[model samples]
Target chain A: MPEKPDRNAIEVRGVRKVFGTGENAVAALATVSVSIRENEFFTLLGPSGCGKTTLLRLIAGFDYPSAGEILLYGDDIAPQPPFRRPVNTVFQSYALFPHMTVAENIGFGLEMLNKPKAEVKARVAEMLRLVRMEQLANRRTSQISGGQQQRVALARALAPQPKVLLLDEPLSALDYKLRKDMQIELKRLQGETGITFIFVTHDQEEALTMSDRIAVMSAGRILQVGAPRDIYDRPADRFVADFIGESNFLKGDVTGTDGGRATVKLSSGTEIRASLPEGFSPSGSVTVVVRPEHAQLAAADGGAALQGTVENVVYLGTDTHFHLRLDDGVPFIVRRQNARGGADSFAAGSRAGVVIGGDAAQVLRD
Target chain B: MASAEEIARAADRKDIRDRWLLSAPALIIILVAATGPLLIVLVYSFLTSAAYGGVEWKFSPEAWVSVFLERDIFDDTLSLADANITIFWRSIKLALMTTVVTLALGFPTAYFMATRSEKTRDLWLFLITIPFWTNLLIRTFAVLQIIRNEGIINTLLMKAGIISAPIQILFTDTAILIGMAYVYLPLMVLPIYASMEKLDFRLVEAGYDLYASRWQVLRRIILPLVKPGVIAGSILVFIPAIGAYVTPSILGGGKNMMISNFIELQFGQAHNWPLGSALAITVMVIVMIALLVYVRNTGAASGERRG
Candidate 1:
């Protein structure tokens, strides 16, 4: 037998999970395969009930896959129970032991290994200091705020020094500002600890902000996996592009193909050029995906543009969003800031041109 | 014209009056039927008995003193002094044993019921409570039939050649324990199920995720979380077991008499009202002390949780 590749921290191969039996059986995850690299912060992003949590539970060894296997650190851990795995999860609910103090909660995993009391104490102190929760060590979990509780949960999950930390929507419970702050903190913490982190969330912004690479899931199937920049700039399909951020899709048909670019005829009879995504087949209908920020506003007399009337202008403090409708009643969105001069104060029903460059858009087959 | 405050006050007065009008008859019945008998029992407990028979109106500390001091009175044979004390101790022991056994059996059953799926949980809970809806006396008599000489147990044992003769299971302390435990088992189960039902099961999962074994999860997390249920179920099972009249009288066969049976004997065969009242008062005092200790222990335990 040949030796296995050693770059992955977790290698999930053809894993499937089905709940119930017979006619009532429902497939939660279907032959999902991914190799998570060592010490990289990976995210599984999807809508609710999309089986991201199920995949996380499978990797944590809390549940077993009905088919295939999960390998951790080059070892198959399909039969190992959660306690036997060198991975710990910070649950969505935090799952802190209400009866235990912060210190006891953080020290529980070390105590489970029958560590010496002094060692447990020192490690617990270190973890508390890491989370900046040393002062709240004696407080009961119920006595602390939600953010503090979140810190305690992080301390508890991290104190064991596991090879992988599984976080199931850990920041979903926090307020908006706190959630934003934690996203940065979590990225820094992952770097400082150098532990492979697999974070699950329905919030696309969160996935993009903290993860080194993101596996976008939908209906139990992984649609695409790539770095944040790659995923945002070069989405493999329409679903991934739409789910990640705001995108204006114009239905089109491929007219010509060059080295790596394609010319497509839009529904409005206007021709545009875009980079062809990998594995692009030009025979069928396709969509051109352009980010809202990439679409610029120009006078209607300018060349190579689609004409539309400004339906609404929304002032969003830092930037403004323009809702435009074409003559054929096709709606499109264009985001503008004060720096872009064409439409800082366009009125409703004003004729304008929406211009997107060839490099800013990608032609998607599906 | 009435001001807003004056009108609101008038409306509140009318609401109170309407409630009083609706509840007046029930209040009168409660005052007459319930409080009247309790007042009589209190008055009887205080009054001294005349030498011939009738109760003396004059108050006296004689009965209280007889129970507390004058140790010889506890040994009095004619007045059922010795029997009363013996029955009291036996009742307490039986009650304690029954509570302990019920807890040992009921806790796991309740926990299982609480953790099961909604449909299966309802089914199990119904099975536990089905026996309670049946006649209590019929269930106790059914136990008699099962343990008798020609009962199924005896026939099976005989056929298996485990014993040459039927075991004397009826009219014994063990029989009483079995009867009382079966009769009060649902009461023990319901409160425990209620407590365990409200328990945060994530706490147990957290324990396991933290590397605790199954036993440690149970002892440190599950046990402490469901302690309120244990205490509540114990008190519920013990109080009734101590004052239980029918089960012990039917199962104990006069040999294992409890306080309830002694008190009933004074009221029936002996026709000794004052002594019966005194014995009833003693039982009440013991129950109060047991409750006090339970409350104190529970308070201390919760205090520890908070600390």
Candidate 2:
């Protein structure tokens, strides 16, 4: 109860959504509840059909839950129309009005609010500057590039200065370079506007880079909600572990526990120590998940190491990825930063040691 | 041998020649079948008429003058009073009425059709065209059977006790208008439906998201985007409805005469071929002028979308 101490910018409590009816009913979301704090850059990260978009739509007033309350800044706005809501969405398609000029599209929300012409003009000019689209203000939306159109959409949504901004995969259409550029721009925009941004994206890296806190959703349920570091380092379950980043899972039996750390003995009798996650059981089979980046390949060691022959060495601009396997044929990967340590590179068929620190590997419940 | 640049220019000229060659057949057909008759009619309008419903092979300005003047063949003085102008005005009014009524009725139906699922829209479109499969005269008579007193509609309404008297809906201007609309309803619907089909519903959603009221969004966004369809539908309905002959002849009881009906009288019972030609030429000129203006406006609107 004390965890969410501050006032919530948007609270979606006990929301359920079922599409269609009768025999064809689909449960898009079930018992979804999350409180987003003001000025927090929160992202709902999930694969397609995970109901992340459903939850965002419910908050934006584009959709209503079949059963539950949606409170925007402590006021229930469930029955209100989208136009009546104090939130704006940057749509996935960057839904710019093609008939209108960029400035007109940006100033549309202000015009709808009955703002004076001079004030609307000033705000629109400021927004154009904010999005670095001041020179393209007079051009029609159809005349702008995809990235420029994206900025116009962002500027248009932000021009209204809503309590919360909902972005529905706003960067999925952009290429890699542009998407990366906009991620930083979006973070800066959120910071400057000081508005709660509930962004939805399937891209894990995009979610990690822009969000202060992220809620990992799957099958219409929130699997975990925490800061980007927390979600990446200590994922709640196997699904979260496999989804966030690349990891090598080793099936092992717990041999012993040393306070916070537990030593697990592998099938090949190789003993490794790893930090136990919460509620970790002792003296049973467990799965030890270690990221490729966390495990390092060194000279064959005598203790606390899984010895394998280097089967492949791949140079990826920033790091070297070495594929190896234990004597029992258990495959392992080690991603070593190219700039770190000695100039020695492991060749295929060379004996190597896979060293994962106790805290580097994560153990999950089942 | 041609140089590289000269060869490129030659290839471009060959490309242009091939394009023109591909269109030549249709162009030839249009000129021969469509404009050929109109050109003959245009020539006939300036010629003199003989004593017994034939041409005299002489040039005269009498057919053009007769539209607004009444004069004896031997008389030098011309009276500005004429019934032809009245008939022309009445035909214009009736055609305008048909267009306005069909537009009002067809717009909503086309919008509904456009909003339907693809299969449902196809089914409705097929049904709309089914009426066109029948002969135009037969379709007009079919409407006659439905709306006439003591007909199916009258019997049904009387049987339902909604009407004690047989409704006098037959052989009136209302009947002609109804027949025209029923015949031309598909024309108005098809182009509008085509336009609406291509519309992005996301634009409407974006409008609503920007705090625009439904009506404001429709007026500001939906209407403008679909303007091309409305213009196309209007042209499709207007040009043909203005020159319609049979709908008025069959349903008008010869009382509500359109310009086509008047032109028919000139060529048939009235025996004034030059006058008919002149009136036909005049109507064609008017329709062309209207179409040119509409095309100009639509071209300007389409420019905004492109730029």
Task: Indicate the TM-score of model 1.
Answer: 0.88
- lDDT (0-100) at residue A274 of candidate 1? 85
**lDDT, residue A45, candidate 2:** 98
| Model 2 pairs in collision | none
Would you list the C-alpha lDDT of every candidate in the order shown? 0.86, 0.87
- Among all windows of ten consecutive residues in candidate 2 chain A, which has the lowest summed lDDT? A1-10
For model 2, residues B106-216, the per-residue Cα lDDT tens digits are 888988998898999999999888987899989888999999997899999999999999999888888888888889989999998899899898788778888989888
Q: Which stretches of candidate 1 lie over 4 Å from their true place?
A: A1-6, A255-260, A267-271, A279-282, A305-311, A326-329, A340-351, B1-86
Candidate 2 matches the true fold with a TM-score of 0.91
Best by DockQ: 1
Tell the DockQ for candidate 2: 0.50
Local error of candidate 1 at residue A107 (angstroms): 2.5
What candidate 2 gets wrong by more than 4 Å, as runs, is: A1-5, A254-283, B12-22, B72-82, B159-162, B297-307
lDDT of 2 at B58: 93
